[model samples]
Each structure stands twice: as structure tokens, then as C-alpha cells.
Target: MPSHERFRTRREKMLGQLRELFLAEGFASFSIGDLAERFRCSRSTLYAVAPSKEQIVVATVRSYFKTGAERIEARVAASADPAQQLAIYLESVASELQPASATFFADLADFGPANEVYQENTQYAARRVQDLVTQGVKVGVLRPVHASFVGAAVAEVMGSIQRGAIQEATGLDSAQAYRHLADLVMTSLADPKKPAHERRAT
Candidate 1:
């Protein structure tokens, strides 16, 4: 391979490693030098990923969430049932977030650019949930509850989760909170006239 190709591959690998490190331990405390040392790479090599530590954090965080969203959507797409899609969506989100430590969430909230990425992702998630709920209602699988109202309520709860308010009030991390949200949403959408076992099968 050419030198540039090798460098590109190495940089991509470094970004993946850095993302895992940040997810496990948070990015707020890692200086460029510290990251370089930890990765056993030169400062210039680290600069290949981003121009600065802050930018690196932003890039990594953005990539993490972006990849996670794609995976979640892929899972949702595989399931044909709208009701199942709603449950799968939220559960997939929880799974994607399971690796992130509390410190990572704290750092994400503290940092402006990284926090923006997180907030944007959360907003998209809220909208996706709303779409799923709408689909469920259209298919006559869910109760005829107002989709717009459900969307707004989900948006508020998601925003609170992003801001750490949910954690403060419920003692649940983002992943666990999302699981509970899945349960709550599914319960609310369940058709009352359906037998309990029938509802569970959906």
C-alpha cells in the first residue's frame, strides 16, 4: 500500500480506539499529548484525525452516534410489524448506549460541541419514535392515542435525558432510561380490547 493509504487506515483505527476510550472513560480529561501517549502515536498522527483535542472529541462523538443510529434503523427496518418496530427501535437505542459510561455522559453534557451532537441525535430519536407510533396507530395495532401528543411527550423526556435531569430524578443511566421508555410507550400503545397474550405477541 502507498504511504498515504497506510496512514489513512491507521488514522481510522485510531479514531475507533479513541471512540471506545471516550465511551468507557470520557473525553474531558484527555489532552492531545495524553491521547497521543495512550495510543502510542505521535502528536502529528493524532492531528490527522482532527486539528485539536476538542475537535477530535466532537468528531468521535458524532461518529459514535451516527453509527449507532444507522444500526438502530437497520434493526427497525428488518421488523415488519409497526408495534414491534417501536419496541425494537427503543431497545436498539438502549443497546447502542450500553457501552457508554456515566463519565462519558457527564463529559458529553459538559462540552458544547459534543453536547450539540448528542442533543441532535436525541431530537432525531424523538422524531423517529413519533413516526413509529404514528405507524402503529395507522395499522390499528396501537390505541388511537394522539401521535402528536406522544411525540411531544417523548421529546420532553429525551431532552431531559440529554440534560442529565432524568438521571438525577430516576437514578437510571441513559440506556436503562431508554428501556423503561420502551416499556412505557409499548404499554400506552397497547389496545385494551385485545387479549393480553395477543398484545404480548405483537
Candidate 2:
């Protein structure tokens, strides 16, 4: 491989290990030297991916969520029904977030760059939900609630969840909180007269 490809390959390999560590222990609990030791590599190797510990954390967070977005998109595309597509999207997100601890999310919320990735992801999801709502309403599966209002509400709830407010109030971790959020959105949008299978949870 070329030199740059070799470097990219090595960085990705190290980041895979780092992602697992962050999920297991939370990013706030580790330092550069700590990560180096955990990976059984020199501090220089860690620095190869990022100039400092903070940047490494940001990079790891980006990588985790980027992969998550791909998975969610794939699952959403697999379904033909709007409600099923929305449910699959939300469930995929919940699964991706199942490993996040309170501390991990707390750190993510406080960090600017890392938080932006999360915010973008949430916005994209909200847009998707809005589109699904529009589709379902047209198809008579969802009630004629304002799609924009519901989309914005879901985004607000997601913002609260990212900031730990939801977890603080409900004692739900990120994954559980997202599941409840999905349920709320689906229940609110589902047309009562629709078939039971259409309203069933994913």
C-alpha cells in the first residue's frame, strides 16, 4: 500500500480498539497515556491519529456515529411502509446507542466538535421522521397531526436526551430513552382506525 493508505489503515485499526474502550469505560475516564497503555502501544502511536487526547476522543465519537448513520440508513431503506421505515430507523439508532454510558454522553454533550456530529445526526433523523409522517398521513396510516410540529418535538426531545436531562428525570439510559421517544412519536402519529399491525411497535 502507499504510505498514506498505510497510515489510514493503522489509524482505523487503532480507532476500532479505542471505540470499544470508550463504550466500556466512558471517554471521560481515560487519558492519552491510559489509552496507549490500554492499546499496548506507545503514546506516539496514539498521537498518530490525533494531536492530543481531546482530539482523539472527538475522532472516536465521529467514527462511532458515522457508522451508526450508515446502519440506520440501510435499515430504513429496507422497509416499504412509512411507519415500518420510521420504526426501523429509530430502533437502529437505539441499538447503536445501547453501549453509551451516562458519562460518555455527558462528555459528548459538553464537547463542541463531538456534539455537532450528534446534533447533525439528530437533525437528519428528525427530517426523516417528518417525511415519514407526511407519507403516513397521505396513506391514512397516521392522523392529520402537523408533521412539522411532531418533527420539531422529536428533535427537542433528542436534544434533551443528549444533554442528559431525559436520563436525569426518567432514569433511562440513552438507549432506553430513545426507545421511549420513538414510542411517543409513533403513538402520537398513529391513526386509531388503522390496522393493529400498522401501529405495532418495531
Highest TM-score among the candidates is held by which one? 1
lDDT of 1 by residue, 78-155 (tens): 888888888889889989999999999999999999999998998898899899889989999899888988988999
Cα distance off (Å), candidate 2, residue 37: 0.7
Q: Once model 1 is optimally superposed onto the true structure by TM-score, how far is the C-alpha of residue 40 displaced, in angstroms?
A: 0.8
Which residue pairs in model 2 clash with each other? none
How high is each candidate's TM-score? 0.93, 0.90
lDDT of each: 0.89, 0.83
- Which residue segments of model 1 deviate by more than 4 Å? 1-8, 195-202
TM-score of 1: 0.93
Per-residue error at 149 for model 1, in Å?
1.2
Rate residue 40 of model 2 by lDDT: 88
Top model by lDDT, which number? 1
